[model samples]
Target: MKVPGTINSRNPNSQSVFENSFVKTLSIAVLMGIFLVDMGLGLFEIFSTKESPLPTAVVLLIFAVIFIAGMVFYEKQGLDTLSSLVGGALAGFGFSFVFVSLVGGVQFALGGGISTIGWDQVISAVAASMIASVVILKALSYKLQNHLY
Candidate 1:
């Protein structure tokens, strides 16, 4: 019989540093910061241009590199892959919503008290961030797993 509050020696894969609440919260916060900054920059580049595709491509490349690097680092730390990915997506969504709301508030405050912010853009940003993070995480995880084995 396994005793409570004792490590299960039979389960080698049961060890997870991310199981700690503090560590998991910190990880989510880190992911949120990363998504905020990365997606913020990408959104800026995207909205700054209406006739250019090069900037968008550059943003995608930058995000890809960052996501791959993060995945490798997290994998090395033995974080659960599914949890990490889900956290990433949630972080992305949160960041997108916050960023857009802030921008809208700023615009309302500065532009003669007029609200010109588009809700569609905010929604699109949230969706894009969530979808992109999930896809990127999956691809990187697959590649990393293959390389390790």
Candidate 2:
């Protein structure tokens, strides 16, 4: 009784459940939620704590999520590899810039009236994070290119 051009989820012979628009939108929303929550927690920890914001477990999780999502988007959108790399690298650099600045500011505020954090540390941390992000994302992107659905 299903229409020829309509999606029929109740029909056993219909397309995959994931092929539905709602499912796709929900999945994307969930992924975006994960990324947003992770960034929020990281920012909160950076400003409210004396510890480094770059927790290994948390950072690795974010990186994995970003890499997988980026690759999927790249494949779906037919994005140029070079543009993706550059865009991702710039994003990483911008994030690191903000993160390092907050960390440095916190350290300065908590140094008991002395500025313990120096520009060298901030520059080095930003550079290191930007380089690491680019390398990791590029490697993963290259390995997974055209291999994902």
Candidate 3:
């Protein structure tokens, strides 16, 4: 049996230099900061526009690219299940927020006004995205652990 605090026994050879808890936490925090800033900029772009969808489209693209890059980095580094899950969840949550904001912006521009959008809608979207992301990550982790990936 493997020790609780030790590395995974199945992939004992897959250790990375960033296996330390502090480094992992710090890295995640930094990624979160980036996400928050990007999200803020996207929101600002949304509110500052009533004539073009280009800005929201660009924000959506950037969010997708950043999230994809982060996931790819984790995959290449062979990070543990927790790391992958947390990374996916963060990226998914951020993307969901940005996407929802973009939709709201479009609606506002199209005369839906602000009454149709509320914190409840945004929270629900984020929560649903978080749940879906966790489920997906868990399944992928299981597949990878079983060498089915």
Candidate 4:
């Protein structure tokens, strides 16, 4: 027997869970797409098709690590929305600058260096990082508010 206004659904929680998962997946893919396109355009001068695949892979790996680490740090720090976004931007800029600088330095020391990575790379990386963070946060926020309200 069931109350008229209190019917039970065997999978009552299923809808919210599925929706959350879908939103997370979609947001992540969008972030990744933007990051890849920006990286490709930014690095074209530094890496030609012949020598690209490896550096591109390495750079993206670093970005992924930074992205995850930044998210964890922001969550742990309990940063507000804007603070988290700014922190991400700063972290991304510093990480990109340092990573590329060291790489450029090594190549220079080896006497085969043809170019360097600089401000544009850092700016793009930072912007992409912040954008990704905000996107995830915004998606989660809406989902949470929907459930709560």
Ranking by lDDT: 4, 3, 2, 1
> In model 2, what are the clashing residue pairs, if there are any?
none
Model 4 C-alpha lDDT versus the unseen true structure: 0.59
Model 2, span 1-76: residue lDDT tens: 6676576536567788699976765555554443433344345556666566456575555555555566556656
The true-versus-predicted C-alpha distance at residue 109 of model 1, in Å, is 10
Question: lDDT score, residue 4, model 2?
Answer: 60
For residues 1-149, what per-residue lDDT tens digits would candidate 4 score against the true structure?
A: 76555657355545664378768666665666455434444355245433432366677777767766776688679998777766776676568645664554344434433225455664566567657766777788898988954
| Distance from true location, Cα of 51 in model 2, Å | 3.8
Better-scoring candidate (TM-score), 3 or 4: 4
Query: Candidate 3 residues 1-149, lDDT tens each?
Result: 78656655555576675987667655555554444433443464466674434565776666667667777777778987678657865786576566656654544535544334655654555555545545665687788898953
Q: What is the C-alpha RMSD of each candidate to the true structure, in Å?
A: 14.2, 15.4, 14.3, 16.7
Return the clash pairs for model 1, or none.
none
- Residue-level lDDT of model 1, residues 1-149, one tens digit each, is 88756866456566578788767655554565445544464445446543333344554555455555666666676878976665555554554445454454444335533224455555565556655655666688789998865
Q: Measured by TM-score, how close is model 4 to the native structure? A: 0.35
| Cα-lDDT of candidate 3 | 0.59
Give each model's whole-structure lDDT. Answer: 0.54, 0.55, 0.59, 0.59
Candidate 3 colliding pairs: none
Which candidate ranks first by TM-score, i.e. highest?
Answer: 4
Locate the minimum summed-lDDT window of 10 residues in model 3. 32-41
TM-scores, each model vs. reference:
0.31, 0.33, 0.30, 0.35
